[model samples]
Target: MNINIKKYLIITLLIFLIVNCTGNDSTYSVEVTNPLDSERIDEFVIINFDQLKITQAQQVNNLTVKNGETFIPSQLTDTDNDGTIDGVAVVLNFKPSESILLEINLNSPEKSKDDFIKRTYAEIAIKKSAEFKDGKYIGGNYENINNVKVPYNHIDHDNLFKYEGPGWESDKVGYRFYLDWRNAVDIFGKKTTDMVLQNVGVQALDQISEASYHSMSDWGADILKVGNSLGIGSVGMLDKGKVIMVSKTDSITCTVAENGIIKSDIRTRYYGWEVGNKKYNIQTDFSITAGSRLTFTEIQIDNEADNILTGIVKHENANLIKQESSIENDWSYLATFGEQTLFNDNLGMVIFYKNSELLEITEDEYSYIIVLKARNQKASYYFGAAWEKEKNGITGEKDFVSYLNETIQKLNNPIKLSYK
Candidate 1:
């Protein structure tokens, strides 16, 4: 079933341009301009057929895209989730200052579609029913779910969620946030690139038992030890040097949107959240892309506050890395790297965003908080982690820092995109 997850946030600058039409025909060409001087890979672009004036014969639903002579697999998406299909999203790789041509065939003969390589996944699963009168679900068949209306009497450790909450991941890493009062985030360090969450926690649906993901497995293990701290970008507000987590919310509703061949996203609304003397409602969106480790967040609240913060857990063994962007109103990064995972191995966690949105950086015994100023009750940022065990993972501090810097630069400079 297709669900409307809201429009994909343009984390990367999306520019659609139509370059040419070879006479009156079903085939047309688009030029994608990579304005950057550095090689960019795994770039994603979406093509709207309607916008391109490309029409298929009545009842035709197939399309094929060619990058020169090479046939590339395209992912069909209902961009607006309006039931009717609108377009296809494709991945690209660009050399510095590259302009790649894409040929779109609106009425291409239907052929058996070759499966695209899946690099991302998202899931929110829970036991189908309560097993006890006290609202405890001990054990039962678990069902993957979406748009869950959180129970009013919900409390932490209820076994109401798989992996404790909604989980989203790319090939490089995995992340999840607690659905209960703590609302903290955590990371799952992957040892393989295959989509593995489905098999990772299938056996521990019982409340009396927990998912075996905590123990080392072939796919990977739950690496972060999130205590009371802002596990990894958990939403909160600063009150007297302490982070007021999303604890006193009257209600919460979660909806899963896209589960990716390209990207995956989930949206949630927290109602009547009480922080200190102020009460507010918040809407959040978290998404990750194929081949990327970053999980980006977009937040909108009913009330504006200057001290809205998100943070990463503290580790005595990790060295803190902070960078101030030289470009004003551009991006900066906050990161930590060291032997901080539950396995006591090398792990790196980072958050990067506009420096103008940052208010302060502070810490307690449990976390290092990046307090942000919310204007118009809105804020956004990206957080991610890397483990040395993952296939082709970032292992050294210098390499990790280079990754962060390159990511920030990419965010600062967007390419020109268009289709004909």
Candidate 2:
């Protein structure tokens, strides 16, 4: 054979082998069942990639999920930020006691980020070149940042973070917490059902002051006045007969774990948390899913014997309602509804937790709290809010109560995913 012809033939053979090996596609069969008799709307379905009976090795980023021929709102997540996708997350619905079979197809043509409608978002934005006063960032052009250690001098209203601190949201609602001594979570009552957190504080509005996010725009407003209380589900440690905030920490770092089209989360680590002369490390994982009003939390105090607590901020006219689930001791909720929002409109706040973890339900001057005997210093709970002005949302107290009850039922009876 001629030398050039032989070289071309060899190259063509290699290309053919590579295409045959890498271009093949595979589908994973999944059967998801809703155990409850009631219909569940937008139930969060999450499964680890390892659970899928995958026949061929595939890249997680190039995966897609479909119900049939239609694409579903889904994403691959590495919740721990270890650079490896460990799970598949999707939002789905189920009829009364229905079972769903879904296809998780691997090696599908990778979808563009814009191809998926963004139902969830999270961010930590900071100014890069403005000014620092008293060892704190004052003002500058804001930009998205991640995995940053919280400076010791950083304090409340320092303008270090746009809208106080890291914010996360779903299509239903939004949330933010002050990354300072306050450590109180606040709610953003959205008027529209669209994803609005991205343009909240940074985007210029036509009919408001400089900080239009605080004022109600076409999107929403800062609805919660946190003050010195646990505005929503802020974590605390009951020490020396007092529930102290995560204030006295040797060092703290905030990381945006997974900000996505389907889910988003923030991981905050408080190292060497000192309370009552007892030093204990603490970490918290806060996540939100698409089309849901709930923010799920996993708090770790690093001390097994310690009882961690969380609370809903107190409002003058708010009515606190406590309800237990019908399933003996599985799940329950503590909620409050009234004119609690900053707009003087109706708002509802809730905390859903397992009944077994309940240690005490008590109150302070600033908040209504629940103390849980955290197992292994680790506990999981959920916090949520609803605004009456929200588009086609819960309006009255009866509707709010009904919403809470349905949420409790869904939590008590989760869907069962049977892999085929």
Q: Write one digit per residue (lDDT tens) for candidate 2, span 226-302.
A: 88888899999787668798887889889888898889998898888878877888888889998899999987777
Top-lDDT structure, candidate number = 2
Cα lDDT tens digits, model 1, 70-161, are 87767665554434567777778889999999887765764335457878888888777557446666767568886798878767776767
Clashing pairs in 1: 15-417, 16-417, 16-418, 17-418, 17-419, 138-207
Runs in model 1 with CA error above 4 Å?
1-29, 46-64, 76-88, 104-114, 133-135, 205-210, 418-420
List clashing residue pairs in candidate 2: none
**Could you tell me how far off, in angstroms, the CA of residue 69 lies in candidate 2 after the best superposition?**
1.7
Q: Rate the local accuracy (lDDT) of all candidates.
A: 0.79, 0.82
